[model samples]
Target: MQAAEADLEADPRVAEVVAAARAADVRLVRFEYCDVSGVAHAKAIHVDQLAHKMVEGVGLTRAQMALNLLEQVVPIEGMEPVGEIRLVPDPTTFTVLPWSPGSASVLCDQLDHDRTDWGACPRSFLRRVVDRAAAMGITVQATFENEYYLGTEIDGRFEPVDAPTHAPVYSAIGHDHLDGLMLETVDALTAQGIVVEQCINEYGPGQREISVRHTDALGAADQQLKFRDTVRGVASRHGILASFAAKPYPDEIGSGAHIHFSLWGRAGEGGRSLLYDPAVPGGLSPLGRHFIAGVAEHLPALTALTVPSYNSFRRLVPSAWASSTTAWGYDNREAALRIASPFYRREEASYNIEYKVSDPSANPYLSLGALISCGLDGIQRGLEPGEPSRRDPARLSPEERERGKVRDLPSSMAEALDLLEADAVLVDALGPLLSRCYLAVRRSEHAAFAAADVDFEIRHHYYRF
Candidate 1:
């Protein structure tokens, strides 16, 4: 039976999607979203119910947003299951599941029963931040270069699918070793509307990085969710697992979801890169300088969102290639923020900034929202960051660091939460409810990790991704 388009009562795009799903004989649909813990969750329904589900939305427990990475509902004071929220499907995010048979998926925005945005919803908070940037005549474009490990479980131990001695950063032999999985991953991501610019074997054994083309801010975060799903699902199809844990093994390079961003004026006549100017020193426009300074200023508190998990801190050590110091630099990987200049083109379109402190376990929406809000704060206040560092902050002498005003980021999750609480602007941007709940949940994770072994935690996270 054909599902009537108008009967769906959602946006016309949603109606068209439902009609298409019916025509394609899709048996089930997955309403999917990322929870507060950065874990992707879904509620599946038969295709026959798509029409009603689109308008009414599938019911999800309010406690879903209060859970930790282990699916345990964190004992946050205001986030108990005294209520429910609706997962309203976003038609713009609908896509057919390439790996899962006879099933399609769409992302959703969490809402109260009255259809108003939920304060604790990460996706909604991201949208609010995006709108704030819009009101200021600014646009944020971003992309995530995600790195993950491919491994298989054997007799309760996780082992890499392919191992090579020493670091093979972009080794052709390493890429060829997993070329089948990489090609399949590319195809799967392409099918889901995520543009894969390139994929390669990274420095660590069994580690790989995929760089997707950048888009608008919100779409960038949405694509990250899809990218995670695509990589994990495609790997499983090839009889292996893809783990995005910040540190799946001790003594190995951890995976990161490094964010690259560029600021632009709003559409139409305002369209232009605000980060580039030929007249400025280092080609960084004044507005861009302030934005970078803002990010550098608030980076300590922002780490609570970007590197939320306890495992994330393991990846941010002195020589892990993930920056731990609050400094910006020109193409310096050891700095928290790096100014990326395009080698191929000297144009504004190629100018951008890269934030290297974040890991794959972070909620993309929250991470990106915090970043945009801080950059906007910089632009408004005319904050000026000092000269960019030429050397890795970790490798600098104490006198050199003091001279540069460079400081180490929070060393632990507890310390990061402290910084987040102390930062007024970041707290306001996240709103009280979200800030409170996030702190409570993250603290619990931290405490849990302190009470357990690192290997135990690694095992707990490795297969879940």
Candidate 2:
């Protein structure tokens, strides 16, 4: 479904933000977006200056490249002349910066100097994949599960809040400590046409997750990126910080952008999600089986796309809900591929799956596009995906694991990139020019791990800050 038009027609709550921007004479309208690496950044110009340059776009030197996730500038040929990038805002993305006093926010696309899509831009990259899917007469609908940490004021220092000393799940602890800020975050996101289902206190001290219920791959990825910025923006208002570094703390779970999705062919659609089959003992259709099979088989290579950081591997250890192995299971949370509950008799929306390996560190566009590629490959080849990882992973015996034939994901960014380089399918899917640049960035990032003993936050953010 498209973005809700209703939210765009100045609601009272949003009107306040509009008035504030106007009253402040916010001369420039800024369209904010991130590149392939998860860098929080923006490109803006004055109102009068906006129209004149809107079509021409703005430019930033390629020298601005950050290490995988860190904000530090990486060494690149400063003369490469990446040139001007056009910024087109989705009016519906209008949301005032919750933390930036008198400032506002909007989502953007990076275009070439000639007004064409910028292949290297993350949003543009994802948009291209979505367009390709559209050409095939099929559609993918998705939502984001934003997992993160919450630091509260304690003796004037922002620290992890006390855990609720009880069973924590869903929205149980959502309003206990972070109610006010959480509500405001939800409100601001809602005003931006984001359908946030609910907020929850995730496992680990000071950890929380906001589950956004949305549709379409592009919209889901966009909202995920926006929410990352929104959380940081909102937390700053309370003198706290929201970190998206994969594994910010050794003892706590790192943030993740876990995605849930279903696929269909136009109107009547793929006649029901190929991934679900109530007819089977576990309810996975033949087509779905092929898709999951593709995912499982290519997961080793998919590592470069899914868990795309050095520290990202640190969080992949067992028990953190981060799947260390590549396996699929029906309703099994520990497996790398988690299948959703069965949709019985519903001919349109039954089967679906979640790739548990991806983190907030991945370039959503490239990674998700790669997932579609590998899955479709399995479908074309009639690949039959394996059964679920039946035993509790934490207690699985060596024989059981061997019998399950489960393989583990790479332990580092270096290994993942190697796998990606070896995979012709994925490289072709991502495009040579983009793959070369993408792989080049990762290699440089991998080398930095030996640069020094970077802190958890730095290790997690070194590439995309």
Candidate 3:
């Protein structure tokens, strides 16, 4: 009946079904949604019922709200009132289940019982930050480079399958495990207009990396969450378990969820990238410099979300790509805020700022939001990051780093939680409700992790997915 409704209904997920539904003689459509922790879920609808669902949104038990915490589908008794939560179709997120017989899925946005946005929705959290950027005549563009791992069953134990299949450390030699799946996932995402940019095999055994094209911050975060779900779902149908854990092997190289950010204006005007500056020292725009300062200033507190697992700290070692310190670098991969290219002075060519602290387990919505919040705060306060560490801060004799004020993120989820607790500013940025929910979930996770016998899955999951 309306333009937006029509556009959503005609989304690729619904449109692709014409052939599959007709060929299979099916009369049902499925709509899917992701809870706070990024877990995916789906519900089916009769073909005739699609219009109402798309126009008005579908309803799920309110218990689903706790899925991010409780890790189960059903509502927990005494947890909260289990009424109905709405799943409104995100037309931009339609994709066919490549491994499924003929099923297609469209992502959804959450709605409360009163037909309003759920305060705790992760996507909405990201949107709030995006809106803030808009007010300042600034637009942040983001692209996610996800380094995930593939696992295997070893003698009744889950382990990183040895190369050929497991891919021994950084072996540039032939290993096809990551190749096929990488392209398949990318192609599926781009087909649905998700804008996948590049795919590569990582150094860790069974590790792979893929990144989306840089775009609006909100859209990038939304697409990243959707992309993770899409990849996991497809891998699942193929009988492969896609774990988004930061590290799956204790002794192996860990995985990272690198975030590359740029700046622009609303409606995509002015279109200048914020990372470069010909006037300021180090070729950084004042806004860019301030943003970097904000990130370095609040990195510890931000970790409660970016790498929020007990198993996560095991991966954030100094030597690993999972950065341990809060430092910036000009063209150094070892630093958290890597200037991907420092030699290039061109506005378009000089785009780089890597959040090396993130891992696959992170909620991209929260991670990116936290990042923008920190940066925007810096810009508002005109804070300068001081200086970019010329050498690898992680390796700089502790003495050298201290002089530079370089600091490590956190040694464990336990430490990260503590830092998050002390960060009133970040807590304010991420609402109290969400901050509490997140802290509760993370604390519980830390307890369970520390209590468990440090096993292969917990250690390897960091990279495996």
Candidate 4:
């Protein structure tokens, strides 16, 4: 307890968080963590106990991390119910819940009895990856551009809120239909310190996309959890359901949570853009090319982390705008890696790469951590990305695609898992404990889906994310 108190006291933000919680009359504080399946789980403490709990942390069963999407514990050694871990809240992430009265939430890291990071903690994994990048004089910034459907649930069925109107994509009418819901959602997010960059109606009948401004790698992952919780909370208050499932409805176009990231030099270098160079084509620096090559080289294995769920495969098809090939191109949405166009007068500042393979079903901390791990490997090895695809790789002749080194992404979760198991780089990055636990949990879910009916799959995934 002394060590825990010392750690909390050392962080200046902890005092401010306590003051804010007291001032806001916060009755309960939720200490939350996202599991490997991307499902958020929490334990609440009364405000009267928050100060103590903040130091001692709330206890969670080690088997909690081993639970699959269906709530069954996967048989992972050392993750049995006999052991206990602490959920230590990160003070910097403290925010009053705008939608839940008298409640506030904070993200947490799983710590062992000695207060050191648990080897299987996803948040800790991201922290390690961030430290690795910092050691090389680099900083990573990222954001998730997520699309979700807003609708009503009746008799265990989901129907879009705008099903009757059938508003056109990106149309003012579509925006008007969801104006109240989106407005409340954005306001709630902003109140919690999340910056809303843009919100628009999407292609599906009741689908919408909202993007937050980018921040440091860890903060970005934290914001993603905040974003999802805020949206779902606000939507429930409005008598609607919000689903970030990769494919909320089988017949409709799938939703995606694309990851956008950029690299910058450390503070000593005045934080210059590491991904930009005026002399290079598309303004991508040699280091940036290496990073892209690294991601492309390991895209298949990366998918096991980025698009981990079984339903995610339904969205990663050819011509779906969810890239199916490990090819990069300038502003090409069909390519797995897209060199996003820079904003006017902000070329260096705005230069970044977008990885299209990710979705909201992924645990942001793990997905982003795996991505950085791969990119850093590329930087260290000086890997070169092959020729950029001018057109969609799916549209190219077989020979042309093969000649350009464009390879198809994994079409199923099993395939992706196999690739993941074989990739030494990613396995090492995840560490032995985390890698084994993650694989067991994901593989269990895959097997359950394979044994169930299509309706079972849809029902379980629709609102879980």
Candidate 5:
């Protein structure tokens, strides 16, 4: 066994995990990982074998990373079925499945036979980015504000629960309609240690948005995975289908998993907000402006990671509140980035930027990691974000947009992928192997959708995310 694998066996946490499982009567422990397609896959072991498996991890074929949403394995070199990798669990993420009886789960990091981080592991990629930020004496805190739909399947056709009468956006009546499911979901999430901050009925007929408090960059991604699992699991028990698809119904408003982020100084440097400066106009520090500038500069390529699926484009249009241009503004929903208003008397603690273009179809780890990479590059170059738009860039005339340096985001998955391939900063952040495999998988999906129809696109993406 490798030294790191051996060390896992000797760690006291293994025994504690085993004893806790026994006490809780957990019959199986699932070692889970979110794939490049944002789909969660797992291999469960009998409780009796938990300790041994925790150390050695469950073996998986390397080709897993090359698999697209359609389950086709793209032909990426070195990511074939001939090699193997391990799913090494992070014990801190171990949580009993509140929605699934007699089962527990632990998030994992993919490692090679020698126990080194595999380049294609999304979790490991985020770790590398977090380490990079730490080297610069900065820390990132973030959360994914996910909006999803609640529906039921009838005769293989999915229909929203509020199909007959659309609930008004943010209406109390909508909350009453899904009260039981929403409350149980919140309880389940709390049971798993995730702090729920808000729940509301969204603009779509049967859409809902449940948000959680922010955490350290890595934990934020892990929490997002847990949050998705819990919401879906609980909804299933009620015989309801929950979807985080960007556009679940062609005629309805789309759902988004907006990202809220802030940077901070290291604990040694008083751990104050690096993005806050009360004396400055808009309460945004110079560092915050640079970070936003970096994201704007790379917004075209960044969309390939954030709004990844072909279905995502269905929602990212002008005046849709999903953002269509590379513009930042104070509370402007039509801009890709929004500088949120800080709370009264708590500006420093509450200051953060919201990336509006992201969706639930994205692998949280990859999107967050790529975001930090772009922001860091901005800091390194001292880039300025220019003027914040008070009106929608899409509403401005072509001449006005050019004068303001505003650019439109890619309108389709294929276009976004092309931008990503040509971007040196993002490609370098993903590293060679990961960039190659990710592009291969996404390209395969885009090709498949290109050959198919709109119904085919909606069918595949609806429940998968």
Candidate 6:
């Protein structure tokens, strides 16, 4: 076989994965894929057929890509249920579920009828973006600090597992209350090769943040998808639901899947950071500055993907530490892009950019992919992000913001969608087909929110994600 074909087979790792599953006594294997709404869909196969299914993949409807959070299919052309797509198992993502006995799961990539990459597949879109970055001699590393609410459904109403309205952030009481769930979650994730750096009780009642170690961009995105599933599944074992809704409670701080990223070039044995240089101002290398500039230039339209859901906008206002402004600052939590600099220990590799606008409701693959696209555009054009401020952009005078080119993010999903529709750069990178599919689902989602009450909408979207 040729080198390219051999490399393609490496992704499935069929023989090795099948052996591992058998040794683990995994009777059923779930082929999982995330839809446009960041909702997971799965198909299970018996252990006896796991090997074959890994090679051939499982069949799913084309309409799966068009489904909204409501599970209703949006009428996008060429996405009808009349056709089938293959959910090809990715061997590297295989994980045995500690919460579900005799079962294992692996994330899949969608393949069309002729075995070509599917245009509407979000996972595939991310891979293409990663490949583009690689061609430019850049490597993207990323991780998500996911904040989520641990609550229970009592009498059809959601309540925090241990509501601590007045308790201090990272309070011991809430941590001790949910100790079992948190510890078990760490163990389960560690067993699957996912590094859990830390876990803490966030400011909101029952809200917890689990920080994971950053990895290659593709691996990081896949790890996040698994992290969500692992957290929810482990929470289910404890008899409570773990909801990743952008805003599970209207009055409380919403959960965010804040992303931290850096760019790198190859070095001996591993890679060297390309985003940092102690000699430069703010320790930002030229490549790093250009990349940040690209992100700022595209952020207005990119909001449609990063903060995709209608509820997502509710959490983007000022002082929430979820900056809605399209600006970057050193250590500024109020900017959409916050540059982490002057690393005390490892200055070279530690400087990175934190994108604070996204929530857990976003599909990690597409969001991260779009991020890479913007960064690449910046590098190619040698863009400059203007200025970096420690002060909040909202506090800046109108003339000051205008001079610095700082701007606010779209106030609503409708406005964000409109911005995305007109951004030729982003649309080209996302490809016409996937872009159209995403727009259809989000547009329908916005309309649904317009027609529903807050309570009804929360109930409709809370758990499935």
What TM-score do all the candidates reach, one by one? 0.96, 0.84, 0.86, 0.97, 0.97, 0.96
By TM-score, the better pick of 2 and 6 is 6
lDDT of each: 0.86, 0.68, 0.69, 0.92, 0.91, 0.87
Q: Pick the candidate with the highest lDDT.
A: 4
Residues 145-205, candidate 4: write the lDDT tens digits: 9999888888888998888778888888888886987899999999988999999999998
Per-residue lDDT tens digits for candidate 1, residues 62-154, read: 777888877778877667888788999887887887888788888888898899887888899999999999899888999989999988888
Error of 6 at 54 (Å): 0.5
Q: What's the CA error at residue 276 for candidate 5, in Å? A: 0.6
* Candidate 3 Cα errors over 4 Å, as ranges: 1-30, 68-79, 161-172, 175-179, 267-269, 342-346, 397-399, 456-465
Please give the TM-score that candidate 2 achieves against the real structure.
0.84
Candidate 2 regions with alpha-carbon error over 4 angstroms? 1-27, 65-68, 71-82, 90-92, 98-102, 152-158, 163-174, 268-272, 342-350, 394-404, 454-465
State the weakest 10-residue window (summed lDDT) of model 5: 2-11
- What overall lDDT, based on C-alpha atoms, would model 6 receive against the true structure? 0.87
> Which window of ten consecutive residues has the lowest lDDT sum in model 6?
3-12
> In what order do the candidates fall by lDDT, top score first?
4, 5, 6, 1, 3, 2
Model 1 segments more than 4 A misplaced? 1-6, 164-167
What does candidate 6's lDDT look like per residue over 318-379, in tens digits?
Answer: 77889878878888988888887655888876778899988898999999999889989999
- Return the clash pairs for model 5, or none: none
| Steric clashes per prediction | 0, 15, 17, 0, 0, 0
Q: How many backbone clashes does candidate 6 have?
A: 0
Model with the higher lDDT, candidate 1 or 4: 4
User: Which stretches of candidate 5 lie above 4 Å from their native place?
Assistant: 1-9, 398-400
